[model samples]
Target: MKTRIVRVLVTDDHPIVLDGVTLALQNTPWLQVAGYARSGREAITAVERLKPDVVLLDLRLPDMLGPEVVQALRAQDSAVKIILFTAYPDHAALDAALAAGAHGAVVKDTERDDLVDAIRRVMAGERVLCINAAGSSGAALSRKLREHGLTRREYDILRRVAMGETNPEIAVALGLTRNTVKTYLQRTLEKLGARNRVEALSRASQLGIL
Candidate 1:
């Protein structure tokens, strides 16, 4: 039987890293390097134009963070799988990216075999997360979100709140009405058992949900 090919669009700012990843995937029988992108916007555009099966995305891009890019991609194409490829040293950032909707993550220094395995695993309907050795469990963030009954939108609003964005500002940024933003905020406060935004933020921070 012939192995199925998984076309992947790689997004990274570094030309050298892009070339290296393309070369590595080129040697893999079941994988195809569909295209390349140098920034978050470019990645989004490439995915729309190429409609690749998978996206090997960098955690940090010039125009947006990994999580933002992941969210954008997911919004555009729910069927396309995404794997965050990063050398970023922060575990929290990785968790955030995963929570935003990535199928998996592979550290940049991982061997080609490992990277290929991760992609295959994701294609097989499994979530793969192989980051730095010191990183915590890949599902930790998502687990917490589930346990808290926090929806992604609520979490996003909470994050904006943490960044000191008010309801009107969040509404503008998220394209929601002011009333809707207020309702989401009120629900979030109730979930966190806080009387106000400040207390809610404190509780979320203590729980490491921020």
Candidate 2:
């Protein structure tokens, strides 16, 4: 039986980058290029019309930043999957994207196959982050915090909170109740020896967890 193709919308201000992404997706059997856009407004329009399963979004759109674009898309349709594509993969940026409801992130310099793999993984319902490219700092932070004995879920919640997401947003993303999110946040704070969310975020950054 033939596999279903994952429809994708590619958005970037640069024509060359857009072409490169289209070419890469063309080589992947399970991915179908549905549309391309050169600006945030165009991307939003295409998303509204095409409703592709995945959107490969560049962080530096001509009209808007990637995080804002993702937030706008999410506000329009909560189920729309957005994969942040960028050259700069700083922890702060990654956290912003996550908070804005992006499903995955891939660096612009990522290998073609790895990019394809990320798309497939996100399609398969796994949150994808290019750890080597986009998350080295965050990964190191996570490692240091692991020594403190925080549960995986609590750690995840803490990271999300550090990214500026509210408990309700984190709960929705993680499929936890509002009270459960609060409880996890409290436990995470205790584990990090933090007095508050801001303190925890700062400590996590120092320890390399954000």
The prediction achieving the highest lDDT against the true structure is 1
* Candidate 2: pairs in clash: 141-208, 141-209, 142-209
Note each model's CA RMSD in angstroms. 7.6, 7.5
Q: How many clashes does the backbone of model 1 have?
A: 0
Off by over 4 Å in 2: 131-210
lDDT of 2 by residue, 1-210 (tens): 989989999988888998888888897788889999999788889988998999998866656545567888887777778898887675444665676799988889899999999988988899998755555645643565567777767767875674457999998999989999998888888888899987886776565344
- Per-residue error for 207 in candidate 2, Å, reads 24
* TM-score of model 1 vs. true structure: 0.68
Q: Which candidate number has the best TM-score?
A: 1
Clashing residue pairs in candidate 1 are none
- When summed lDDT is taken over every stretch of 10 residues in candidate 2, the lowest stretch is 133-142
